[model samples]
Target chain A: MSRPSTRPGLPRRGVLRLAAAAVALPAAAVLAGCVPADHAVTDPGPGPGGAAEGVEGRVTDARGRPVAGAFVEARGTGPRPNPVPEIAVFTDGDGRYRWFLPAGSYAITVTAEALGRRTLAVTVPHGRAVRLDFVLG
Target chain B: MKPFHAIAMASVLALWAAGAAASDRAVEAGVRGPVPGPSAGEAATAAGMPYAGSDAVSETELAASGVTLGTAPVGPLPAEMGGSEVILNWDSRMVLKTTLYPNRAVGLITRNGAHHCTGWLISRNTVATAGHCVHSGRGGTWYDRRTMRFYPGRDGASSPYGSCGVSRMHSVTGWTVNGNRDYDYGAMRLDCLVGNTVGWFGMYSHTAPLNEPAIITGYPGDKPQTQWISSDKVRQALTRQVRYRMDTVGGNSGSPVWSDRGEALATSGAWGYAIHTYGNAGAQYNGGTRIVSAVLNNYINWINRP
Candidate 1:
């Protein structure tokens, strides 16, 4: 494989140029082992204003079973005073809960009246479906 | 204008230095000695399946490539750039600049000539980037992968080590089903043990103040190149969106927004300016979904569980 280069301090544009060259130049010329998988493809999604949707998934226990009636809450990172609102839901029979929100930072909390609580933090981008599964003790 | 001029000059200098130092520290830290790698949950291992989609990759792939995810320790940036800016205000724990990764590594999967997105390791097998990088919403569908690979230590288009396939993936319900930007975060369970060469980052259990200086870092495109902005100031919004004065570009999506202390508070995604559509613009505005303590706690519990 081609050895990773560690030359720092290259200008931002310079780095970009180098990257372009790296991509265009023959992989065989630089390094032998490191090869770009022919499987790799690039599909830049639609530009801004595409208003991507959010993600949704279910939370379950250790036995591959859903945690019924568990309380599910959602929180996010933003500025203060107007920080992303924390939304909550209860798991249905299938241990599933869903919420629609804007694209941003987020954390999910699962709590049961008897089982305490657990939280998982994640980042959701525009037009994506992020799946977070919680396994309660 | 004397006092105003002095303040403006100070701010400008600070910003410049912060930007420079942020990148410097990230590169420096990446080269440092061994850091902790991601651990597998006993329950996950025993069950032979990860909670989310950690099973996307196999052990053979991870071993062949030596790919791992997580954070490295980054030193402080120059004093200017407001490295001490506070972004989240919780209880006693003040999330400072010393704790977060200003830059992040994102890996895009090319299968059947389509590129799906995922993030790189900062501290543990824990990788933080954009939620959209992995899953998507088109035709009322979610991009669920049965198999994929990750290149954590990729510097440019080359993987210094080998590449590993994903074992599992995780995201919040609101983010997946509701398109809620507020709760846009995800985690993955790797199939193999990421050695010390790759590490994970720390999280702020509490909160900090608003309008604190913060740094944002990430790989804009599939290339392993990264960028940093130090002197940027962010105003915490009541809506959980921390608005900041920083110039970001495309391919920067899924980057991490970190406190001066190196604690990741958010990840980059959507941009506020119209130039975002063209993928070329300077002095443009980009936003990241923040990592609140409540959500982080959930992730911790899931990852650490036996």
Candidate 2:
């Protein structure tokens, strides 16, 4: 992302001159685009919460065994004005939670109040089903 | 006078003239507020926003005072995920790292100017960032010099067009005054319209599952003037909270904990929650500060209201 500039007194001409100067310095562009974008998992099918579109996952302990009654959540992110909704649910006796979510980018967090908490941030594309598993200590 | 001295004098005069003209334009544009840049002492006033004693003012009074104390805004996702999902999409060999911080990093600048950090603009003028970035001293008072204005997409001292002031500031009731890590989020009311800039990110109302993939973004001091993004492997999930590993350092404290679509899920807080390490080695860990419906509603009401 580009940081905004706050220099007080540059006219249009001055701005052009600065732009020219900046171009002369190749490192400026490199520095300008320094931060890398996030690479997250994208949803390939219907998002959770949609009819026949949801996330199914199991919460387990470090031993790779199922842990019952884990809390599961589905979240999504988007531009301003409108954004995806965040949803939450609890696991069944089989330690599974099926969350229905709108199609978009989401960050998921799961917690077993009695046991512990864990989080996963991902994107749920449209018409796709994503599965996540949590292992607590 | 020597020739070099004469040249230097001319240059200084030209620079002064340019600065004066710019100041005049800013005033005409209504960007200039009554108070000049806030001093360090003034930034400390935010610490005062949250009262410590029982005799302190009520939330109503604080709201009247223009101090917005509540959660961030949450909204629905876009119909289409069309924008660039990745920052550096061309690079395929790069691998994102996950880290955590024991102490949250907050960006502080003078009141008038913008403070640069990876923060989320939850409202038109309200922003959510780490409390440590805004406060200092034993009581964690807001620091003025460091409390510069905020420019979401800032490039060093330049803020192009986007600029906002700290009209009001709010944080979790207890964390505001006591420096509690569990609730390390802080919100600021802006003087300008954030919508004109990079725009604000929406909050999530529903809960998310643990052990899912996540991406983190922020501007690191080591690489100032630029933003960094990283993806972490989902480790586990506990009750009410989730833990994950990401590569983060000091200056990234105020960075937004965002979902894949750039929506902010939580503000980076202390090292960790419960037994997990908030900061292990050099990585930072974050717990989900659920943006449920009620919390999101409160945040929206606060920012949307006059």
Candidate 3:
């Protein structure tokens, strides 16, 4: 038997169910290509709120291991009047790459010599750091 | 007069005529506004609109297509190394004064309403840039003109030369069709002739441009909408690419890889040799798509277009 819930608005089992749902929502979003598993609230780092937005992410291989030296190319595919910039950057030794981009939609492609390539579309909100991770096939 | 003396005089006149013709071509390429004297010979010939200058795959191409693809092997690249370093404010220089000649012509390119890249004016209306800046390639479509804009000499919030919407975009089959990295160059035709005011960069094909000073001025991703510059010498001049150790980051694609012809940035002497396209990635050098004769000819053709 579980102990009584500590001064809350639900039974112990109900609280557990709600907690499970909370934990599963992010994973479901990840599978749905909404955001990464860790995306909770967008982080707009310390600044005077500059016009440019940011995209920061890590690249990993199929086995979930960080893959360094991968080329991540982002092409702007827009909303109208304002399009995103075209950018191509490589992942660091820790398989991380980040860039500041103006707000807009982007078609991002990741290519690795050994593991191959993949493309995904993402929209960066204004003045926020959007996390976009990749898992190569 | 002796027959030898007559022949010598004729030969000297012939050499002068050839030199004059070459000079005219340089002027036509928009090297120095317009020479002080007569106009350059008739506009660049249109006979070579879509010439594939050379056949070489970029190091990135190996990954794009796992099948080791290329008509010829690319020449030696710079030493393999790490990615670009994060620069500190003291170590970096930002071009605050954007009204200067070549600086004014080098503009910031934006796709849709958000994406950014660097482009330099090559003609009254044509802006040269990286092919990837216009098209995704190897599984991507061309960027729509409705979403593109160019701001010459844009420093932060100031677009000193105003802005021009894209009328047309241009790229070669190697990039648009084949997705070849060595062919990663393209251009945009602006709706207005802004280059006339901001000035455009002159282009030339150097059979050997190695060791010539390479000054790349463009907007870097780290510093949004701000233009910065880096300098170095051409470390490796391949068949269709030029590698340099110049510091650069994302968003510098299509920046002019140019030389001031050792004339102290004379308005008449600067010429672009390549369109900066790639960062070092893991390689020891950053590189650009070299402007070969065929590429230069194609640019002339594009420039002359309506």
Predicted structure with the largest TM-score when compared to the true one:
3
lDDT of 1 by residue, B188-293 (tens): 5444444223333444322443665545543332222322232355554334345454443333445445443332123221111100111111123335555444
Evaluate candidate 2 and give its CAPRI docking class based on DockQ. Answer: incorrect
Query: Each candidate's lDDT (Cα)?
Result: 0.41, 0.40, 0.63
TM-score computed on alpha carbons, candidate 2:
0.39
Query: What are the TM-scores, per candidate, against the unseen true structure?
Result: 0.42, 0.39, 0.55
Which segments of model 3 are wrong by more than 4 Å?
A1-137, B1-92
Each model's TM-score for chain A is 0.53, 0.53, 0.57
Sorted by TM-score (best first), the order is: 3, 1, 2
Candidate 1, residues A1-137, lDDT tens digits: the string is 97549655566767776665455343323332322111111122223333344546787777778877675555554442112222224566788765444466766677766667899876676656577778887
Native contacts recovered, in order, as a fraction for each? 0.01, 0.00, 0.07
lDDT of 3 at B20: 29
Cα lDDT for residue B54, model 1? 27
Model 2 over residues B1-306: C-alpha lDDT tens digits?
854444445555545533332221111111111212123442222111110011123446435443333222212222121233443332111112111110011122223221133455554355555544443211334434223565444434433323445655544433333333333444566665433222344444324445555544555433434445555634555432345565443334455554432222123111111111122211234443333333343344445546
Global Cα lDDT for candidate 2: 0.40
